[model samples]
Target: MYRAIKYKIPVVTAWSAPGTALLVTLFPDISLNEAVAAYITSAVVIFFIGITGYFDKLLSWIPQEVAAGMMAGILLQFGLGLFTATDTMPYIVFGMLAVFLLAKRFSPRYAMVWVLIAGVVLSMLLGKINPVTADFSLAIPQFIAPEWTWSSTLNLALPLILVSLSGQFLPGMAIIKLSGYDMPAKPIISATSIASLAVACVGGITIVLASITAALCLGKDAHELKEKRYIAGVANGLFYILGGLFAGSIVMLFSLMPKELIAALAGLALLGAIATNISVAMGKESQRDAALITFLATASGMHFLGLSSVFWGICIGLVAHFLLSQKNRNAVPVTASDSKRV
Candidate 1:
């Protein structure tokens, strides 16, 4: 629901990039079945929130700056991974950067894709890719019957849903607003949740609104006419379907790719999103303190009482916001629209 870059790729609900590394880290022993089941549960819960219009009610209390702050806090570390990767894989990183810049110069929308292609090529050339056994076959969906328990539901399903809300959905809603689109929140939320639930039976772990990625397609950069830009969304859905049709082979390709290569591509893809989110989070004078608190708390990677840092960030940010604002009684309150200017 948050920010979108110009990739125009299908925004998969559950992707395995470093983006969901927190989930992976939280559930170290996460099996495909468990992952899928957790996603299914989370998706269904989110769908209820959407259909009941509870998500809109929830958004009212959360100012856009705080939402953006939480998002930036969660995502800021992603861009930094690119710099870290550069220190170890100099040629591959440099090659990817070169391709990113060149692609941006020509076809700005596909710059991230080119960076990914560059990573694959350079990694292969540098002898980083491991040889894999060949299997020429159509991708078949493996039905994973889920096993759910109180502990599993609490730890896995809840966290996945929270992350989907804080990590993906909130910022997604903000970005859509910032882009000046009058889109309704619940319908999109319901659609994604239903999709995630359906896909989970076939091993998809999560599906969320491509918030940041959707921004790429929403802007004038995607199309000269704002109204026509929705074509990008349609195209993205097609890409998602195509990817699902070939999920098994895609998973194999991803698994065979070096961790560094995947990390580099992920980091590169996130640079623009990170910058934009930071700008939005820090732009307001009234909300700056709250935003900063949220960002730092999230970046600290705090986990408490079995909850992730993202939830803590929002809680801490709101506390900071209320406390600081109370102390500055003379100062005019910041409006949600005002915070969204960035």
Candidate 2:
């Protein structure tokens, strides 16, 4: 639902069915029962956090460059994923890359779309594309009566709140900020959290702001007229709905092609956004080192205290920046005294 109505700014949940399977394998006792319960509790907590509107105050203290740096580091992998994909599907990747380059050279804005076309057509010709075999089913919403326990609330619910806020929401807002959008923290938070809570009853886990996918829709490549870009987001949301309705069929269809094909297409599509953020991150001379710290930490994918690298990246960069600032301030008095003696 979030992806379907993302342009309307509803936050939705995402999942990896394989990851869920692994969770079941690891802890047979933990099942969808706990997931729905924990998810609802987490959403309530997040919604409370949003209503406080404290994040806006926090944002004021965080320099824009640091945020940009973290985002650049976060997205750098997507830009580089194309090369990794080339190792497996060289022909498709090569063809996509060629079209991407040509389209970029000529049109710049529509290059990524052209590359998608090239890849899909080439895949079809190579007999790599397969027809959808799965039958359609109405995605009837299901409900699970939540079992609220101290352990589940603490272990699962708390972590869900933390990870979703630090991992998904923060970076998503950063993307909006870097794109010159004015999305206030409170409204976006309240809106997504409410959406999350509403869906939790149906055993749904999401409708959160999307960082990577949002970048694709919000970037300059989406349209020449900047104001018109929201339309792209609307379209993306509509597609998400369509895809969800026929998820089994669509998943099988996407699964037929090489995973690398999709990665390459997405990577090529995001190149412009990635490059723009990198430029913004490292633009200022004074902020350069701090920005580098943020970038390296984020790109390194370090996670601590149950949060993602993006959060730690900002913390580390700010610490380094404060240390450097203090050192410079302390040196100023000594330099003045030395000059007076001379």
The global C-alpha lDDT for each of the candidates, from Candidate 1 onward, is 0.72, 0.73
Model 1, 55-81: lDDT tens digits are 877777787778777767766776777
lDDT measured at residue 227 in model 2 versus the true structure, 0 to 100: 68
- In terms of lDDT, the poorest run of 10 residues in model 1 is 1-10
Output the number of the TM-score-best candidate.
2
The digit string of per-residue lDDT tens for model 2 on 10-113 reads: 23234322223323443556556777777788778878888998777767667778878888888888778998988878899989999988998898876877
Whole-model alpha-carbon lDDT for candidate 1: 0.72
